[model samples]
Target: MTPRVAVFLDYQNVHLSARTAFLPSGSSGRHGHVDPMRVARRIVRGRRFDGELATVRVYRGRPSPDHQPVAARASDRQADRWSRDSRVVLVRRQLRYPKAWPAEPAQEKGIDVALAVDLVRLACEGAYDVGVLFSRDTDLVPALETVRDLGCHVEVASWKGTSRLRFPDSQLPWCHYLDADDYAACRDYTDYTAA
Candidate 1:
């Protein structure tokens, strides 16, 4: 039987990494956005084992409408677009604005914790044979380790030349290093900000 793969995408992390890795120098901030389903399939295909893509879980941070109406609308639209695919499961957390309001960039709050929780929770529930995390955030390492301890295989995917979680004195957790071709195939140039 083919292994069922569950892909967890940390949106900002992956987007930023992809931009840095593949986009032309001085590309716009939003240029690195990717389609969740496309990315999920690409990574699954890159895996060493023959696997079936089971689900794509996208964890994102949403801007507050009160503070940034335009961005809020764009995020909502993107969410609606992604919802068209049954395999895509989107979890959104509100962005945390700084005390200075628009002066400082709003930070993604709770996204890492949310993704980490689901990574471990889904593993314990036996949701899939393999879990593929797409982020370089070290905060998620513990949860990935927990999933591995549960006997469900855990892997990570990061843009080539970007950081990824590593285990000391062990090779159990594998990583899929996505390259330019993968970025081209998975990128979403849809310009979600457009009305």
Candidate 2:
């Protein structure tokens, strides 16, 4: 029997990692931004899971205009495209803190909580046989444990050196960890693009 897989993505974290890890240095460089949906598809393919994709939920905070305009546009376009696809679902929430922050900070709020809540809810509902998370936040440890206890397999996909150090040891024994570099080979970029 093919396993049903549910994929949950932490948009800000994944995007930040991609931007920092893959994009080239320089203010004028075209940011090499890979489509998140495309990245999700690539992850699914790399996982080689048996069942069809049961659901794909991407969690992102609404973008502020002060952020990189071009990159933001590209991300919106990609997300719009993904929403039209049958296999993917986009879930968005506003970042809690915008004021009193740097003009261009790398972090955001609410994504981790959103991901965690959805992961546990879906697992408890028996929505999927496999749960895949594209983030490295140690805050998700409890959610991972709950999903595993529900008899669903959990796999985490993240950049090689970008993930939280405590994640590996904190995860349940059955949870699997996949380094993003293993799956990002085809999407490498030599230049940075503003986002």
Candidate 3:
């Protein structure tokens, strides 16, 4: 039997990792999107899944609940027909402010927590036999462990040339590194608007 698969993407993580690894070298046609669909499809290509894709969750941080998010901001305009067909669920959270109050702390927070919660929640629900997570954050370790205990396989995907994963890799088992070609193969030229 094919294992049902669910894919989770940490938008900023892949954005930074891919940008740092591919953008600086000018390899992506300098035009691309770490398209959530493409990335997930590539990761599950050969894998068997008897059920409908469990879900494709994309987590992103917004400056304000009212602020327009980056492209994944496609969360808005959901009334359109395309959104219904695409079905990529967006999980938006507020960017955090450091308690110490850094002059400019526009960095995102709570995204890992959101992703982890959904990951373990879905696993416990038996939504998927495998959970594919795209992030290098060690903060997700505990959640991944929980999902594994629930009998869901976990796979971590990140850019190959970036930092060596500092998380519980030994337990996760499958690690997919998106290389230059993999990045190029997944680019959505239409989504490219800037360098």
- Candidate number of the best TM-score: 1
Question: Whole-model lDDT, candidate 1?
Answer: 0.90
- Whole-structure CA lDDT of model 3: 0.69
Q: Predictions ranked by lDDT, top down?
A: 1, 3, 2
lDDT of 2 by residue, 88-184 (tens): 7777754444455556454457777878898999888888888888776778878887887788788877765565423444543332343546436
Off by over 4 Å in 3: 25-32, 46-52, 65-86, 97-103, 164-172, 190-195
For model 2, the local distance difference test gives: 0.65
Candidate 2 residue runs with Cα over 4 Å from true position:
27-30, 64-76, 101-107, 164-195
Residue 84 Cα positional deviation in candidate 1, in Å, after optimal superposition: 0.7
Worst 10 residues of 1 by lDDT: 164-173
Comparing 1 with 3 on TM-score, the higher-scoring candidate is: 1
lDDT tens digits by residue: candidate 1, 26-110: 9988788989999999888777789999999999999999998999999999999998999999999999999997788999999
Q: What is the C-alpha RMSD of each candidate to the true structure, in Å?
A: 1.2, 4.3, 4.6
How well does each candidate superpose onto the true structure, as a TM-score? 0.96, 0.73, 0.76
Top-scoring candidate (lDDT): 1
Clashing residue pair totals per candidate (backbone < 3 A): 0, 6, 0
> Candidate 3 on 1-195: residue-level lDDT in tens?
767778888877887778888785665532445667777877777344443455678897755434324432443432122235464778877766565544655667788888988999888778888888888887887887788778777777878888533344353456777889889987655432221
Candidate 2: which pairs clash?
30-192, 30-193, 31-192, 31-193, 32-193, 71-195
Model 1 misplaced regions, further than 4 Å = none
